[model samples]
Target: MAHQFSLAYLTVQGCPPPEQIEIAARTGYDFVSLRPIYMGLPGEPNYALAENKELLRQTRKALADTGIKLLDIELARIHDGVDVKKYLPAMEVAAELGGRHVLSSIWTSDRALYTEKFAELCDLAKPLGLTVELEFVPIASVRTLAGALDVLRSVNRENAGLMIDAHHFHRAQDKPEELDAVPRTWFHFVHLCDAPAQIPTDREEMTRILREARLYCGEGGIDIAAIVSRIPAVPFSIELPNLARVKELGYEGHARRCLETAKAYLAAHPRPQAICCA
Candidate 1:
């Protein structure tokens, strides 16, 4: 496999959906994560592809022409005043775009309610052939690999899995050995990046560090190799959001460097056998 990496939208969140696909292809990435939903938060980019027929057509065309696959679609948050029903349109579009995963987060502290609501979303995504990845962040209720695993087992939906990021993994003090307790099928994909060995104490600070200051695959102190060795054979998303570096090299250059560095790492430390690009 010559190309087996995905360019995460957050890596270059400054770019539009269509351009993300084009840049991914130009930078030698195998897949691109699509953002077609309003994050329901201020300052986040929103693409109304669900209703924009022409825009959706263009995005689809970009993917088809570039041969860069649609790895996932995102920000289906299970938070206050957010209805799971609203994800239906994006889910429909994502399935049409050949996306297999829905990136989501859990905001409520109510474990039972979160489980039921998450399972409901999974039910909606089931027939559409899209799985729900409940991303665990240090700022959220599902904060650890163990917490995420608990939620997955509680929901127990076939189309539901855990989405782990190395930054959060270390923030929660989760060890690579902890991967043993997680079922192999419980992972749909993994978010890959590295960060400083020193962690911040403030929640907002931690959040900013994760979204704005992530280092490349091996540039930081996090053991990306050990963490990756545990994730099941699956397509990995390069989600380095180094804003300063982006300002220095631009999106295309940053993406190319990230891909090259990641490919070298993967070559040296190959994942478990049977892994294939998505």
Candidate 2:
């Protein structure tokens, strides 16, 4: 089967949803994974589709004009004192935009609270036809594949799934083979990117690298194919976020390069084919 690619918001972080959709279409992406729910990060552009009606309308028009689908919208974080219901409007907007998945991550280390909130998030997103994909961030509370698996098991909801990010997976030192234990149904899609093999020891450096310095797929040292092949062949969302490259190449140029390198890498290391038995 041919691979379907999604232009993740972080790949062109400065662009709004409407512009991002246009860029994705122009640069040959099958879909887009957006950030309709603003996270209030400093110096970040707030797409805030749920709050901005005009922006949302323009975003819808862009997708309609380009014939690009919305694969997912991030991020419904499970943090201390987070109101899960507050994500409802964004989830509603995501569904309205034809998004199928809601990317999420846990920030607070409180296991009991996070687990309950995660389940609640799944329940809330269920009626809207969205799956809540839990991504384990190396600098966050649930920092390992095993910890994420534990949460999934505890939550035990059909709509709750895992989102494997190539950068985070490598940073956590997770064996691609460990993915075998995860249920295939739990994988909707994945975040694809690459970074230097030399893992950072400082949390600040790790955060900086994850947010601003990820490399293009083949250009980095990550064994991307190994992790990608282990999971079901779902759409890959290119989430590389390199500030310097963006400054040099501009958003369109950087996005095009991101897709180009990813395609080349996947082409060079194609997924293993299943054997047909006689």
Candidate 3:
């Protein structure tokens, strides 16, 4: 089967959920990863689909009109003093819109708290038929594959999975071969992008690169094929968020280029049929 592609919210950060769906459809994306659970970043639009019934209605209408699937909702973080239950409304909204996954990350250094909250988040999402996929961000508490694996094993929830972002994998210095040991069942979807080979040491620079300046699939130094080939054949969510490119190409144009490059790269480097070691 051909690898499916998703238009990640970071790719078009300014677009609201409904407009995102329309853009994804126009760009020929099979799916869209939404940001319904707002992060409150500066200048970020508060989609508020969970609170605004009209917004939710419009988002649902966009999906129906364009036939673009809602792949996931993002940034469900397990942080200090966080109430995991607060995410329940977003989970309900995603489920209502036929979304499949909830993208999560650990933002707290407190081990016990993160573990407890992650499990709680998974438990809340279980009934809604959404799998909680944990992404190990370099700037976050769970910054490596091993740390993420430990938490997953400790939580041991059936509805929990792992999300590998190419930028994070490289930034954390994780080897593609290390993916061989991961359970095949934990694989859900992946965040695809590339970046400069010179890994940044400072946290602010790293954060800047992750949120503002990621490269397209084959444009930078990341070994995209090596990392992707080891994971299960899942949808690739294009999370390339280059501010310059967006300014030059516009949202639809940039999204189209991202899809085009990703498709071309995947075609040039086919994945092996059997990824798991068993």
Residue pairs whose backbone atoms clash in candidate 3: none
lDDT of each: 0.84, 0.93, 0.92
**Model 2 per-residue lDDT tens digits across residues 1-278:** 88899999988887888889999998999999999888899998878898899999999999999999999999899999999999999999999989999999999989999999999999999999999999999999999999999999999999999999999999999998888878888988988999999999999999999999999998888999999888888999999999999999999899999999999999999888852111
Candidate 3 lowest-lDDT run of ten: 269-278
Q: Where does candidate 1 stray beyond 4 Å? A: 1-3, 272-278
For each candidate, how many residue pairs have backbone atoms clashing (under 3 Å)? 0, 0, 0
Query: How does each model score on TM-score?
Result: 0.94, 0.98, 0.98
Better of 2 and 3 by TM-score: 3
| Per-residue lDDT of candidate 1, residues 89-143 (tens digit) | 9999999999999998888888877888898999999999999998888988778
Q: Let me know the TM-score candidate 1 reaches against the reference structure.
A: 0.94
Give model 3's TM-score versus the native structure. Answer: 0.98
